[model samples]
Target: MDPSRTLVLNTIIKEKAVFTLFQPIYDLAKRQILGFEALSRGMSGSLLESPDKLFAIASKQERLSELEIICREAAIKQFVSLNLPGKLFLNVSPKALLDPSHPKGETRHLTEVYGLDPKRVVIEVTEQDKVDDANLLLTTITHYRELGFQIAIDDLGAGYSGLRKWSELCPDYVKVDRYFIDHCDQSVVKREFLKSIIELAKATSTQVIAEGIERMEELKLIEQLGIVNAQGFLLAKPTRKPPTELALLKSLHSEVRSSVNQFEQSMAIGWLAKEANAIHECTQCIDAHRLFEQDRKLTSLAVVNDAREPVGLLHRDQLTEVFAAPYGHALFDKKSVIKLMDKQPLVVDEQQELDTVSKQITDHEFDIRRHIIITRDGRYLGLAPLRDILKHITEEKIRHAQHANPLTMLPGNVAINEAIEQRLRSHHDFSLAYIDLNHFKQFNDLYGYASGDSVIKLLAEVTVDVCAQSSSFVGHIGGDDFMVVFDNNDAEVLCHEIITQFELKSKAFFTPEHVSAGGYWATNREGQKQFVPLLTLSIGLVRPDLQHCINSHQVAALATDAKKEAKRYRNSYLFVCNRRKPTVSTVRLENAG
Candidate 1:
């Protein structure tokens, strides 16, 4: 053993060395601050050094048990000096705990001294090395648990016997070690293994914390896997710095909220679309051996339906007893899918509440879970596990209120712009129609504006009804004007129909007195009686050929011409078409010109 390691442990035993540090563990579900992990370093030559290096050397030299007791005491002393809101996570060694003679009085004193609840003090048992006596370690852990101190299994994914340790220890928390977390950003194998650990931890009523989160990408990945609680540098690091402006940290989090809200809205639309059979579905049938091969650990196979809808869910845990059954081997070669044999598949309809699905899985209590199929009419559509839906829901909800449209509820300018840009890139044959309502303001003035709003809503209804063709879309661009999109084949016909229905309905908004008076009304803008004719609709329809790579702004501008022409006459319909063949007479006229 190195002379320095010997010196540090000896002084630590005498309570001479002192070094303090903190690492933050987050509440993944609440997306809020949970607590700070209190760490210690031994002091030497009046210089600060990580206790980590010294702790490792002592453990190898048979002095590990002594060093652990002193370090726990020093951490306890420093922790009493400050006041914080969350639990204090303290590190411990499995070997030290197994000794059965180590002093636990100091840890209990910490709870009493700080007036903290014993449950708030989490004792982290890092399996940095394997244990020879598993039963003894479990016995020691149960004692601490009975005292209301939570037990955590640390460095969970690093050790070779991680699975065995998990089964035997059955701790309150399990942290996927840094080794796995380091490559989590890149390695599918590591992520899959971590996911398996999380699933296992959950099965035995243990909460899993994904540690060593160094990047945002990794944070997102783990979050999607249903690992809601985490600890890492990306969260917060320990330092001698005084209690920071920790509360101000919330202001900088606006972006996260906005992002979550937007995600929720998008998820909402997706759920709605799935409910309507506007999305397709697919199923996953990979087995346990396939689990190792693919490096993923999902509980159920996902199945998507013919309507592009997600329908049924298959949970892996449900197969836990069944997969090992006498006939379980057939599932591997069945190829037809396990759902074929499932008497009652776990499923939820698309139109149902997302929470209902969440209550089914991503749920804390590990019920035998599998695919959450999106279904209707007793048929399979698509499958997505509970985790995917939750990650998509929580993160997407951060920015729901921002950039959303108040009217048609499609998406205001932001989403509309994105859709237009996407359409432009795809270069599919589509028509852009600019729909306008004529004589709207005068009707509002005469009907006291409340009735005018009714007119606007009526026009909106007709526009939606007229363009309700399967592939068609309609949007309200604030006040009397709306927009519609469709395939080139029906673009003109849709516009004409919208115009006819719109004009006829516009008359309903007026009073019989106004009808008798030949469409004249007085308005607040100008008290004089203004003669307004019946409403009309003008449509500007543009296909991809109209402007090969027309941008959204250009589409907006070009669609206006057709609208102006449609509104040019008392009641008219105009189609701004890019593919209309010139008439022979017009061709002859052009030749003469």
Candidate 2:
């Protein structure tokens, strides 16, 4: 150990010169700041300016606990003074925590002094040093928990015996190290590790927070992996005065708002709920049997509590069989209906999407005979028969099929129009892209209709693959024309990706000579020989003005005008019409040979 560095550390601790910077952690699903992780730094430009050096010096001097306490105090003081929203995560080294000289109840005392809630402060046990006495460390953690502070295991995968510590501690939150999170989107091994962590978290009823997400791809991948909490520089960086609101959070909300199932919004489970008789849980089995016998149409009866909340579901066939068995009536007749009813019946909220409920039923392998108990605010509302749900889903599917394009099997003009109108009615901000193929007719004339069809399919495939990432809806408007309704402002990114992927993939359709020449001889609409360029996409993107656009027709007109503007360019082009302003921006992407 450097004696000079140790002297600097002692002076820093004695002077309480530690500074704290907070980096925000977000709930990706909610698009809101969940909390901030406090990072401590030493005095700037000093020999021990870096936290690593400062702490290393303190550890060698056996003053780590003292430094940690001062750091925590600084972090808590600033966190409360700034009036930051959500929990404050303070890093507490396990070695410091287990130190015999470590102060007890110091964090709770600080919270009390600052008038902050203990529950809102999280003690992040950093795994920087090995703990020789796990029992003692656990005891210290238990003391913090007893004080109402939450516990988190920091840098989980980077630590020794991380899994053992996780199993022993059963921390409320586990922060995966940045090493595993970095470039996770491209690494299958890292992805599998994340998946296993997620599965274990679910099993243990713990929340996983992915750390060090510096790229948008990492954020998207983590969200897709079912991680809700994330912290990274991409979202926001650590600052003494952390921002309460994040501008980047708007994109997360947009993705969520746009991804709402249009079909679910149009047709909710409430529409299928049929009024059915519900019996009290205390009702006798014989009485339920009699009611079923009297009402032949009643396939199942909902068992409710005194509060009218559904407790269980009694299937009529199950009840009838119980009574039909020899001496079965005598044994079960006097018992409460709750005894025979399914204790864990499938219950759904009335406002839930039929498709979502259908998935729940199918995924759980629920018996079709049991009625799906529908509730409004936890009270019994009505019952929906599985057959009714299936029939409605089937009818909707048929309607969708009828309006789908024959070639691409994508939603046709009618469905596209309906989607636009639905978004307008809901007063949602969205962008619509009108896509058309350039020189499609000439290409068809030269290569025959089969190759042209393949090209169209290629565009459809590319559009779907790109837009699907943002939960955007793609529709085949007709012949080489298509449309996409984007819920977020990343339409430009999606458009670029679609064009890039199509350019790369579409090359397979052309002969090497034609690809090299970049043109083919074909007869034009004028019935004269002309040089036709290779296939290129023309996209016109327009953000609809929800206030001015009264219907899909108006939106269509705006998009159509934009499409004409895009077609003016010779290469694959995108014309973005900002309805909020009069300005229009055009991007010309060169066609890939």
Model 1 RMSD to the real structure? 20.4
Local accuracy of candidate 1 as per-residue lDDT tens digits, 1-593: 56765665666657656666776677653445566677777675522266667766766777767777667666665666666656778888887777655676657875777567887888898777778887888888888888889888788767768778778767778888888877586998987787777657545757778888878778767765667577777766676433433332343233333322322334431253232111122223344335433545444554444543233334445445555678765654344343433323335444344544455464434333334455443344455555567766666444444644455453445554555556667665667787776677666655677776777778778876776543555666667667666643777777777777776776776677766765774544656655677666667676645344456655555565556666666755676756422222221101110
Report how far off residue 27 is in candidate 2 (Å): 2.2
Q: Which model scores highest in lDDT?
A: 2
TM-scores, one per candidate: 0.48, 0.67
Backbone clashes for every candidate come to 53, 0
Poorly placed runs, candidate 1 (over 4 Å): 1-5, 44-48, 60-63, 241-253, 260-593
Global Cα RMSD, each model? 20.4, 9.7
